[model samples]
Target: MEHFALAKEFPPASEADWRAIVDKALKGAPFRVLENQLYEGFATSPLYTGAATSPARHGQRGWLIVQPVAGASLADAERQLADDLANGATALSLDLNNGPAIRKAAELKAVAGAGVPVFLAPGSSPADAALLLAKADKTIVGTAGFDPLTVFAMSGEVPADRKAALADTVDAALAIRERFPLVTPFLASSRAWNGAGGSAVDELALTLAAAVAYWRALEAAGLSREDASRAIGFKLCASADLFLTIASFRAIRLLWARAHEAAGIASNEHILLYAKMPPRILSAYDPQVNMLRATASVFGAAIGGATAIEVYPFDEAATEPTPLSRRIARNTGLVLQSEAWLSAVADPAAGSAYVETLTEKLAASAWALFREVEAKGGLLKALESGFVAERLRQTAEKRERAIAHRKERITGVSVFPNLNEKIALEEPAAIIMEEAHPTVDFALPAPGAGERFAALISAAARGVPLAELHSASRIVCDIIAGGALDVARRDAEPFEVLRQRADFALASIGSRPPVFLALLGSPSDYRARSLWVQSFFAAGGIEAVLPEEGFTDVEKLAAAFKQSPAPIACLCSSNSAYGELKGAAAALKRAGASHVYLAGPASLLASLDPNDQTAVDRLIYEGCNALAVLEEAQRILRVEELAEAAGLEAEDENFGAFDEA
Candidate 1:
């Protein structure tokens, strides 16, 4: 009887109510419910499924959640490392750049400890990784920038002939065999290709090309095949495309092992794969979406059989990852590993028909690309001819065009749009870096054109990397060799212009008092506050347009909505008018006004009230609170664009105009 009674009294559903129901389904406990259902858990792929591989070797224990800590100042960077460690971050990855950089591993070493694994990115010299390793207790798990492809990639200064001389730059890429044997050379990173605009297939091919270039260079430099095999490493980007990412990584091991075997240096050992989310795809709008994206990326990496993963904060592209964002990003992996027990199952995707089919396709396509790179004289040669970079540019253009057309939408970003997004990106805590926070830093001085002497002092005193000034062209350089046909061009995209125009107009989500007049008792109440309030709100640009009969609830008010739509409908009547109005007021405003409130004697109205005021989801009394909320909703609902989409005006003569806030 109680349940039945409550059902009759229950309030109508609100947006919040719907959200609660959906959220329960999204993160439902027990993962799989017999009554409800199960969203498949994240899974990975393995190379050998049916065939025998020596007993499952205790493949590397836990891998690092390495977050690159290279920042501006030594003090700031040190603080950054401490903060990263405090969060679930397991290690540090340094980014070494030439031209005014600190390279003070010894000085920064004071901040890191024996517990954290410190590694350097591939572009850094082995000496830098060695320096970091010397300071930290863990072995540096990094690669050398010594392959011919690397030389060609960084060939801004080196001559074509002499570029080969930098071969010993990172000890021919094989020095890891003697000292840091577990170090990765190019066994799993394809960032160079992926970041530039290369497709998933292109990434694998280019990495293979780079690997071949490394093998040739290392062999020429007098290294054994085994050493060369142990020296290379690979870095790849994980994305929301889970199947693609898993297929990509699983294919890397299979293909790389095949490449090594073909080169007469096959090893049963698995290649180290460090997967990170691509910064290029990260967006500043609806920054919270970054968290969801990163979570998906982590899932992809875990199931893709990545040896390690670096889940950068969603804000990585927009700004530095804050302690809170970093903690969340890091724990994302920890949660998957511990509570989710993802690591318990290896190559969970191995047997799936789709994954196996995708993996084989990727491998075949990558091998084809690898052969093409060789035909073009290898990765470095492709770089010299701008082949690879040009190819990447074209792909980047295609992606941009897709976004413009809305064929591929980035929610809360390029789509599901919100303009004038005020994103807050906290600067990394001072750990001992080179420069202050971007929000605090002043104007960038003229590149190379600025005073050289003064620049040296500012850079030295501040930790400004000089390369930042010289690389301005990289920004405008159409990564696509040929200018891509701008898919986002004006004629090509109409919504782009519309979206931009509406964006030029701002929204006032702020609160304001409603326009209302005091209701006079009895008949004077007929010319009551409701009449004045409706006029005042409309005149003041509030959405609510109450009518004389707007006071009634449901069944009656349905007729009012049939007349013309208004943002809200206020009820105006005297205490004695209650019996004639109360139930009607509740019925009319039902499923109608964005908000509704009342005026007059509360006690008198209560006596005549036949239906629950709470039924329609709200009951505003004669006060500022209800009025303020109503005004705010009117501003947000924004129903004034009555005929634009219908094109009562333009009809293809011209595009419509955006609403002015």
Candidate 2:
């Protein structure tokens, strides 16, 4: 009855008709060639259509804009928290480091008095939670029992008395349940796996498996399945891949609902999901681009039905965020909510056939992996057995390879880079310390441990030091005593290293690394590859100095080369023009060029005279390893190596030394 005009005007196109139209558009190319295979055995076709049955609908709306306060002192954190709350932030996340200035009970009171919900990092112990609880009775708190599994996975050192520590944390949660009804005692952080190079499916499967483990533990401690579910929350990472991030959150909700149903929990409560922007994808060189990345991530998280979202400051990778940077980050969400009207719609991607198809496929893949982990004795055992780590490593390696070869582009990193820009780096604030107090750990209390909770509350009331309150217990876990797990290296780190070498050269010798370009043929014939060579050099922080005119004479090219200050030279021209410059490489080397790179396909190397004194030292073309090429260029320019000239033998034979545009 409402606006049926469009549907009545045109008939829906069938799949076969759509395929036929696409085939015509593509000429004779195979349609299957467009299918993309993603990690964790997920593949997406070029097109998707609505199914015979509609997918589930997402009914939630609005997400909390969270600001993380990372300060050296309680005062610094409080100041930032107050400012954020005064602005547009709806929640505060406090990240306490291992400094000696442990937050006192009075300071904790002041923080909670701000009248906003608070989330403490796992670094805070149960004793810390107790102190805050004693001071504040109204505000909701999270991470009462920081999940020790995260610590075990990160540090590879099982905490002493792990079982007792976990029990005490749960008892504390149960003790304060009535006073703090919204407190979440346990956090299942999939962000850990995400930063460690795990794919989206890995993050989902690992988080679900970890949730089951925590639920079982809480149940053994006498908590009902519904209560346990209430006490737990999830933290996931948001990536720049917008649709994948949206689908991921939907998959998580569907999977959790199924799990809850299986557990016979009748409550139709929504799961608490906290999504944070990932720092692994951020770059320090062009941090401005990070703002764009964070914006996209926040959009995806909000559309994906995340309950709360945190956007990392653009300059987060360089230093502690300044006040201005924090404000910018906080306002990003404000603009989205108030101006963009993002919060007005719930599950914005729900009805889209593509998103629904993606969600269904991703959910199925994630559940399969989750079951496999359960069969392998749960998340802890899977991690300890190195099964989870191995899968993440393989995926990370493949991704890194793609990025290094320019198959995947990171703007301002392995692609179009601006070398002249420099940002002022700030020093992190100094940590302040006070006298320490010793902590004591006791045995695991029995199920429904009200007596232990009373004891803990009494101890906290007496001003007992947090360290003394949580002294080591007798329970120990040797299974997690191995070395820490490894994640993939950041994609921008290699290019940043090259930039560092160039910076050192600029500071020490007063000149950045320079590359001379020898152009041939008409401007229209060679302009594209010539600009390609410029961008390729810029990616490595190398300045590509071009000639005023195309040189057909080898002598004239050598003369121009002798006038240049750069030690390296590259040839840029059309395939036909390449035949005209047969002696150009030798002449340039004779003119004091340290190395000559030919900008073309690898097969062009065969066209050169093998016996010539100056055979092409390397080829610069598309899909080559940019990192390896930059390292070799640094060696040639004596930026990294002074004793040896860069050799051609180490370059990729089938490709080139550097990436092409």
Candidate 3:
């Protein structure tokens, strides 16, 4: 069969024609209702036509499947690494913080053998990493010592001797570079910035600023511009939102080109872009759904042209990931690469009108913000001045507000929650929590500018500890904030708190918080609202007990309500049925319901008897505050007091902490 040029078979429709049809269908609703405003202060159109012009791909199409390896001991870690490597992982990223210490250089060697890239978290012993890679052949090691500024921003305390730490880090990088050409010992990670509630543009800006600051430091230490650029790498957080994640990755590349051009360096080499899933979006209550979240992140990163990607295990929020969870995460990447054929297309998002437009806007906004940070004396100075912290705090507050009001939905958490679902978590043998170091938030004055790269490298080569390379500071500026910046949080946090209360009720009292559904009229008339009411209650971990059958007789409905284990009842029905529900609502209140909620449009309840509070206490409908509604449900169910006590014990400080990749 020959191609018939099918598009020409129909006449093209104009924008005006489409608008007329939409407006007529909308029945007097405004056209602006279709516009979706993003947190970035921009609106996304509902439709697109021709493709927008996109930048050329400066990197490879394929991404490394960076898997996390952790265990109780070095031997355990080594075995875990071996299993992952043999299964399907292309690279390994270790979380040595919580696991047993890697006390010997041989341990690192045993975990990562040869021809694979290994990324270690910041504060990991660079000396050990250098020693291990010294004997390995073509193994790429990513060291985090070079990026102490991130640690400073996160912990709100600078190192005792800032200049010495900087010099030591540069020296470690120089030593590693000399011994193992594949090792990139310097990193500018945006993990802390993004995880601390910064937007995509803010994260990109801060990352670029940090990269620029490091480049200058490296150059001052005697490395050539090309070498300095090559020695530094980036780690950014990937979100579940598809277009934002894709545009964010692309924006960073464009920003990188501009950084090199501004520095008068003409290099065409692609910089390392490691994409890690943002822990802010993961939920502990519905860990299985986290798999879908991770998949979305990986898909976005792969399409956005990441050099490497790491997908956190779904059970990371609850406990150590079981072997099954680990394999699921690793194979998620494999299936995307081989079966989905993602690697075959370079810049998969390129030329997409929506993506290209978003990328250009993101780059422009990020560049402007980066310039602002630079103007505030670069990333370090801005952080010290509390500018960075203030901006992030404001954004976090706004996001939390949106979540509380139900403007932003977290599925299986804030919406359609399964209160009866059993959570599966592999209990760790021991959870080693890191103790906070006692320190003041004072900045030290530089005693000396710092040693040159050669001297530092020579010192490192002689087995000098990186921390002992410099002199103590003479100047102390007490500019540090009182506590660490708040961790990136999810919209489901408030609702999850409710679930905790329900769990407490079940464990302590042998029952879940219960809410009775007083569904009225025929199945077809009230079934949808009945299910809606059920889901709404479930979000608060409250068991919504519905009648076995819809009732026409008000006495039967009242009788069923009297038998319910809950003191709270919600009436679910159509507008016509609700108009006749005043008597039924009064009967439920008489049946011992402490509170009666009508689940429908608020307009339906506005005409009901205002004098009779017993008939209806409030309205439960879309756009109402979910947190408030759930709290009320808890109060009526008598679980509020129990929940309050349980919340304190259930707090997981590791909420948004991600496994280093």
Candidate 4:
């Protein structure tokens, strides 16, 4: 075989060469334009020249495809579970909060028989854990899902008897370990923080803090450091940001290892990382785009070395998951694994300078935040003092502002929206109620039962209902100062509200709130701004009535606007055209335009209306507060009021000096 060195044929490109090329492409723009500053307090460089000498690896070949099943009844759950298992899901997550009420030992055993691992999401109650273990197959490896700290953070309440509840959880975990060694009893999850719009740093810090709290609790209960570490697993949300998600997962592993090392534990055990797709990024407008998001999330999770991955159904935001949606969600992981071979390598992102650097930065930031949480006396105390809530709020507000200004564009919501998109959603499955049965009288466990798990499991085997089981371990804590971490919000929620208002107006009247594009000169002169203005308004569900042809005369454009039903008008044209037709805004205002908007920046306003500042009521340009502008337009057009007073004209009150034109 002939040997050829490609490196010798092509000289190594220096950083100067790259900068020269980039500078040419950027024209006069600064090189910093290519860099991006993340919410985690780090900037991403445009290029990386050095290679990482050593990088962490996932140390595993593939991840478990965990399918989360939530149904109205046990039968429904069984059906979905069977279908998911058959279609390549390697594990199952029972959404106890919304899924079937698995009360009896028989029900738990039946659902657990899929021959794959079962992760109890949000964790099972102490009593529920007992019931799960009473009939669960010992060979099945999974988690008991007893995560009280996360539950407290999410609900903004601590158990009135916090110590007893936590002690009971520890006892339940110990029992699960004795019966099923492969099953992890505790879960440290950051879904609450992630769902609350926390940054990757927030999620990592919170998870580490919560896990430390659990480790201390477990250790105090006579478990060794290694035992406590082994008994718990981690669950983190994998978002659409691919590189960030990868770095986040990798960073957590490093942090966990560091935490164990600090505790003087020399265990080489890998952390069980379960990466779940977050609902915060899911959009109901264009639900199909969620599939792409899910794919990206799965890729990130797999590359970053998740032990298990769960892909949320695309239409879950709009309605319950239909069978088709469930299959698509399940297949998303299967295709990536089987065809894309995403999981063929351990820590696929390892050795990439960008990923390694990001991982190190994220780990450092998260560790610092974790220490801050510790200074507040741990995750629970931080939540109690509203420290966690405040931090999450700050990040959430920053992210919201970015989305509102269109700085962070959301497809189909803030960017290219489809106003006329008839979303094809399958009708939600009808809830099947279980037939009422005679209530069974079962003696409740004492307030401080010695072995709560044993007592609960014995009671469960006697057919006691889940309600009675939960009543014995119910958490009744005080709500934090602010309500539960601001309810999970999507990036598209604000714009979606605007669309909803538009939909209501359309149903009440015959059309959506309209904005007329008062185009000037030839199509080439105004086409760019015309289209930009149209898409901008359409994002808010406001219909843009574009002129059939650009007009050179201001009177003709104003006459066309007067015939249209739009109460608001935006002048769209090139700077030269705006300078040529300086009377367009005045003419449109005289023709009954309630408000006039210029499509370009404030600089173009002087060309359109040099004498009167109010001639152009507002300017719509890139980086402007788009949501605020659309909302102001809605208020001016009275879209909400139009719903009640359909066909009634809103009197123009802001005609200004142009009224005499």
Better of 2 and 3 by TM-score: 2
RMSD of 1: 16.2
The most accurate candidate by TM-score is 4
lDDT of 4 by residue, 372-462 (tens): 9999888888888889999988988899899999999999889999989755334455543334433445554443323667788788777
Candidate 2, 382-439: lDDT as tens digits: 7778887787778788787887788878899788888887855455666653334343
Clashing pairs for model 2 are 438-467, 438-468, 439-467, 439-468, 440-468, 440-471, 441-471, 441-472
Pairs clashing within candidate 3: 445-475
TM-scores, in order shown? 0.57, 0.89, 0.87, 0.92
Decreasing TM-score order of the candidates: 4, 2, 3, 1
Instruction: Give the Å error, residue 246, model 3.
Output: 1.2
lDDT of 3 at 458: 44
lDDT of 4 at 188: 89
Q: What RMSD does model 3 have?
A: 6.7
lDDT of each: 0.52, 0.74, 0.72, 0.81
How far does residue 129 in candidate 1 sit from its true spot (Å)?
A: 3.8
> 1-661, model 3: which lDDT tens digit per residue?
3866868878999878888898998899887798887767577887765645665555568889988768776677777888888888888776555455553344555655745777776444444454345335554555443576786687677655545445556655666666567767777888887777778878888888888887887788778898888888888888888889888888888899889998887854577888898888888888888999888898988888888899888888777787899899898889999899998988878778888888888899889989999999888778878899888777777777678766888888888788877764345657443233323232322222222333433443444432332221122323365556766455566888788778775665556767778778889889888888888888888887777888787789888876666677888888788766457888887777788888877677655655333478888887788789888777656676654444333222221111000
Better of 1 and 3 by lDDT: 3
Worst 10 residues of 1 by lDDT: 652-661
Please name the candidate that would achieve the greatest lDDT relative to the true structure. Answer: 4
Sorting all predicted structures by lDDT, with the top scorer first, yields: 4, 2, 3, 1
How far residue 510's Cα lies from its native spot in candidate 2, in Å, is 1.6
